[model samples]
Target chain A: MQQMNQILRRIPVWAVYLIGALPAPWLFYQGLTGGLGVNPIEALEHRYGELALQLLIGVLALSPLRRFLGLNLLKFRRALGVLTFTYVTLHLLVWLVLDVQVPSQIWADIVKRPYITVGMAAFALMLPLAVTSNNLSVRKLGPRWRSLQRLVFPAAILGGLHYVILAKGFQVEPLVYLSAIVVLLMLRMPISGVLTRTRQADST
Target chain B: GVGLAGMAQGAAAQETLEPNTWEEITSYNNFYEFGTGKDDPAKYAGALTTEPWSVKIDGLVDNPGDYDFKDIMSEMTVEERIYRFRCVEAWSMVIPWNGFELADLLNMAGVQEGAKFVAFETALIPDEMPGVRYPILEWPYREGLRLDEAMHPLTIMATGIYDRPIPNQNGAPLRLVVPWKYGFKSIKSIVRITVTDVEPPTSWNMSNPREYGFYSNVNPNVNHPRWSQASEREIGGGLFAKRIPTLMFNGYEKEVAGLYEGMDLSQYY
Candidate 1:
């Protein structure tokens, strides 16, 4: 475990950001060259959204990983958060400019469709988190920064719900994503005290 | 005179229409019996056996028996029809289909006096169709239309696209092409067609009645629950293509609007 931590320490945070951003262009290139099948725009839109959700799951899993297994991924959390926001933005852009071009319909969909409404709400929640992700805001806000970042919990849930609602019929793939997010959030609960109390009671 | 005017208009529409390439039409499909993904049918449909195909004509028909594909083809006069194919998923395509009017096929079987509806069913081979193993939709994909809609001149049982027999992915040997309705209503790779008095259950409508109505007509005003139906992205329009406004009844309003004259489209939708 110590050796693994030492190896992880040597990996710069910038490398995480660089490696994360690579899929964005690689996917775009594939879409351009007919590699994303026939409906490239729709495929590209879905791929970006899926990637964003996966990264959001990664961001949510960090604290739980540290708490349960003592595997610290604190250094890459900021990079992962930024990357999640980036993919989310790309997903939104693909829907806006490529998949759906009409301005009125875009606004109408955001307002009217429940799935779109949830998705936009999730994006809105992440906006402030992305803006405050830097060190300067962390220093200025002090402990309040930690409280503000907690918005990610709800944002993650909403993100999963957006996918679940958007999928046609009952699809297991979207439900799995929502389930994973819920389990990660449950793990973050302060349960050590509860566990110790149960152990004490059993001993008596 | 009205028939002449309609023919002239159809000719004009044909002149303006640009049918999608054979590759695009075949590769991008929504035959959910094969799978849900657009490319799934293309990837897996090759395993399906289409040779010696036969269609069972039952229900209220006078001659209820398995009609061989070759015999049916020999009896009918096939022609090209340029149509605007609109999917419920808000995607559009222009297709030049070759087939006989569905009314001719129905007439051959001789519809009984009380028949009010026509229901069609797709072939369900679990070994060939991997998606059928899971209940993505009720297997043996079913679709139905009013007796008049079935007899309409525009409704065809398409066997080929672009002067070639349709590939399995695009519903090999035979398929329904109801130009005025959403694409799913035009059931693919049909094995059975039944004329009946009662309204038969359609696969999509049975799955989600609120989202998919019995009519399944293309109406821009009526939005799907998940997405707007006001506009559609044209398939094969490349990455930056802008979505165009969807037409009422997919631009066959003049021909099909009278069928639902007194009914509310929004309620039915």
Candidate 2:
């Protein structure tokens, strides 16, 4: 166990992010190769889109979890966020190129459909977060790093709302992600006698 | 002496204006004001003001009266009709509708001269309806039919379905039934029926003219801007993509196409 701990301690953060994402590409490739049996196309799109939102919410919960639960799992949040962008890109590519063969229709759908508009907005917000997750970029910006990373909360809410309205029903599976995000947000609220030092600094 | 016989002939013709094949009438509907989904209108329409219902008969009707909802349904015996409902959105349902022909009630109300168009409106009530909370669609749904279309043998006012009083969800008290057209053409929970000289504004056409039109017939040839109309999936089927070919006038070409003589359906659509 001690040897294992030593090995893990020496592994670079970037290397952990790369190694952790090994399963995503395999799942994507399996979908591409027609592994999903019925409604393979729709199933492929659902899996990628669903995972993107799940990982996004997971990343949003990290900092708060570390502070309250005394768990520092946020070490993996940067990697998970970048992984979300990768899956979102794949989802958008499959939908734009495969489902809507007509280019004009795709353009029209993005503009006309409310669900698509919010979905695109969520993806746009992720681009910057993924880019700045690295230590080098975070160090370069200093204080601005915290502000930029804070966007994950709203982005997560938008992604959840997008899926909810598009579904048009209270589907149990997708509702789980929405409920999780809500609980995570609720966890961050300052209960009685439990204010953070940052809150005190801002007040001054 | 010739005047007496002329009155008798007119009465005979009016009596047969109602349908012999009720199946063709009940399966058709106009629940699309709720959503494009086949089950949505029925599920959403339950909140409509079905209780304490009254319809105003005005404009070119001689005996206009505030008819009680139940009294109007009791005007004729209910017939059972099992039909395949086709939607403009490319979905379908096989429903057993129980109701009477609309022409019988219209003639009883005494339609007068120059009654060329039959315009209808849903009882607009926002208080009970949760869907109205959001402006997902225009309120007080409207639909219209030409004079001949209104008097056609296939036109009906459905009161029940699946051998029971029409469920509140499926336009409880009274719902229009016009076979040969897509289901949305059949308006539900009607509050007013106006017999006028000109065509009136329909809900879908007024909201999205490019997507829906006034004379929205069931023609597989004309595709909706968002979806293909050539095929439809039956309700209660699993998520398989299997679809059946849609028929022109929903398989009522023998009775209806003769009415629109020489007009271009594609243009009107």
Candidate 3:
């Protein structure tokens, strides 16, 4: 386990960021070269959105993994968060610039569409987390940074919900991903300890 | 009409419009009964048994009975028509289809005088079709058209495309092709055709009545509550491709607009 930790430490955050960002240019190349098949815009949008959600889920899993499994992925967590935001931003940009070009309609879609509304809310929540995912902000804010970063839980839930709502019918894949996130969140929660502590305080 | 007469010349005189490539036709499809993904039907539809198919013609028809697939093919006069197929999802395709007019088949059935609507039903084999496990739509996928719309020359029963048997993904064996309306209205893998006086319940309209109306005529003005219908991106185009303005009736207004002459299209749509 110590050796494993040393090996993980040897892997740099820059390498993580570099590897994480690879899908973007590869997807762009696929879209440009017609490898995305028919309806490349939709394919590109879906791929970026899925990658963002996956990275966000990975980032969320880090804490629980370190606490329970002796696998400390803390060093790469910030890079994963930033990469997730990057994918989400690219997804939104593609939808705005290429798919729905009309400015008025774009605003109308964000306002009126339920899925888009939830998705934008999730993105909005992620904005602050991404902004603060740096050493300078981490040191300055200290404990407050931990509290602010907890917003990722809600963002992750919303991201999963967005996918569920966007699918036209009962799709197993999206539901499976959402269920996995739920399980991860449950694992991370301190429900039992909180309840026991409250009971002890009442006795005192 | 001159177009109908030209069709009598058979395959050599086939009209080819802005036709989608054969690769596009076979690779990309949205037959939800097989699955929802564009390529899912292509991947999973091999389990569907399309050959030796028969269609049941009943309800308000004089000659109501089961018609053998091969017999129908032998009896009807086949023709070629290149048509623009627009889906309600705002994507469009141009296809060259080979089949006879639906009117010809209706005439063969000897439609009773009371018949006002022609209803269609697609095959719903749950064991073979993975999508049927989920109720995306009430099973057996139903669609309908007004008697006049069914009788229109543009409405055909397509059996083949590109002079080859249609791939199973593209509604093989037999399917309805109403060029002017949204593609979903053209039910695929048909198993039954019923002539009824009352309007039949359509699958999409039943699933989400507000979003999908019974008429489902391609209209640029009336948006599908979720998305705009003002424009459509042609399939096979690359990402960042410019979408073109959608035409009213999908560019078939000159031929079919008169069918809804006195009614309000916006309300009906």
Candidate 4:
């Protein structure tokens, strides 16, 4: 814990921002320049999806890190969450621009294609959470703020489901994401094993 | 002129393989890369390395031998034709493929009388293609065709696409593209083509034999238990258009469906 805290302190906030945002432009550059070579659009979609999913995972990991590692670095969560939304938005944009140029087709894709439907559902769920994540909304919502923000958990779950539904087979990769969400959600539950561990720790 | 050469090759290849439309040719795909997505081949296959490669031809062929990938390319004139690559997953693509007829290559291999099936293997190095490393299925990659299907005119020894040598990700060097069958039946980065009496197991079919079959002829009536094959989305054609009705034998029914006239495709599919 001490070592992690030390490393965290040494790492400048600017470094994290730069590191996180670095790929955004680089991927964008790839898209603009046609660096994807043979299958440019697919390459764009694949990278955008991967980045969005990773950001979602990062958001899920935040709380566990705070509790287990004593890293109360709460300030980064909002930015992290925003970055996740940004990538998801880009993923959608790329799909719209490259794959679905027509509005009717876009609507049809949302209606058809189970994977696309799940992804659209997750994206829609994320919008409210992203909007409510601001301090202004939190202040406006008051005690209701926490309840509103808690939607992120479900949003993340749906995002993961969207990914799993698109994967080739029900292999272990998707299962890992599902497991992580389960752990994160369990950490929030009052009656879970994590609560038992915390209670035992306090007594000790 | 290159145009004349291409036209001549296209003409010869047509009798030997499925002649494709420009839309069908450009939008089609092979499932060797991008893990079975119709759009995946256009993107991920660029990472494939096709040059300086060799194909190991084995099994029951009388003229079993290994040849340089380029040697084969030189032996056959590469012709560009558009093919509608219909995936079993219901999505489709019109791909412009550059290669020669599979019949020409099969005749060169000199199959033995008893050889009833032609099983082909893809060069699936798990380290290179991380997707293969996953325990997704029993084997790395595999595809096969019954003897008559193997000898069919539409089967082509494909190497290049988009008017150039195929980008590595699309199966550089050489691969088999069976236009009428679903994309998976069109084996990519072919390391070997084996003639065998025993029905060789295919990657998807082996993973789920009932879902995939040895004679995976393109038929709309026969649906993959997992998804309907009755309709297909022509990839890169545009997102606006919904899936079109899949034709029996991928529109080569006039010539090939007679081969399976009485045979129940649903049972065989």
Q: List TM-scores of chain B, every candidate.
A: 0.98, 0.83, 0.94, 0.83
Candidate achieving the largest lDDT: 1
Note the clash tally of each candidate. 0, 2, 0, 26
Which prediction has more favorable DockQ, 1 or 4? 1
| TM-score versus the correct structure, for each prediction | 0.94, 0.60, 0.91, 0.68
Give the alpha carbon lDDT tens digit for every residue of A112-148 in model 2.
Answer: 6677878888888878888887789988999999899
> Best to worst by TM-score, what's the order?
1, 3, 4, 2
Candidate 2 segments whose C-alpha is farther than 4 A from its true place: A1-204, B1-49
* TM-score for candidate 2, residues paired by index: 0.60
TM-score of chain B of 2: 0.83
lDDT of 3 at A61: 87
B1-269: candidate 3 lDDT, tens digit per residue: 32654335323323545788998788888888888888899899888898789999999998999998999999999987888889888888889888889999999999998889999999988888998887777888999999999998888999999899877888878999998799999999899999999999999899888888899999999988778899998887778678889988887776778789898988898
Error of 1 at B172 (Å): 1.6
Model 1 C-alpha lDDT per residue in residues A93-118, reported as the tens digit of each score = 99888887888778988988999999
- The better-scoring model by DockQ among 2 and 4 is 4
Q: What is the interface RMSD of candidate 1, in Å?
A: 1.3
- lDDT of candidate 1 at residue A135, scale 0 to 100: 94
In the range B1-269, model 1's lDDT, one tens digit per residue, is: 12666767767877888988887898899887777788989999999999989999999999999999999999999999999999999999999999999999999999999999999999999989988877778788999999999998889999999889988998988999999899999999999999999999999899999899999899999989888898898888787767899999899877778789899989987
Candidate with top DockQ is 1
Q: For residues A63-110, what per-residue lDDT tens digits would candidate 4 score against the true structure?
A: 777766667656577777888888899899977876444566577667
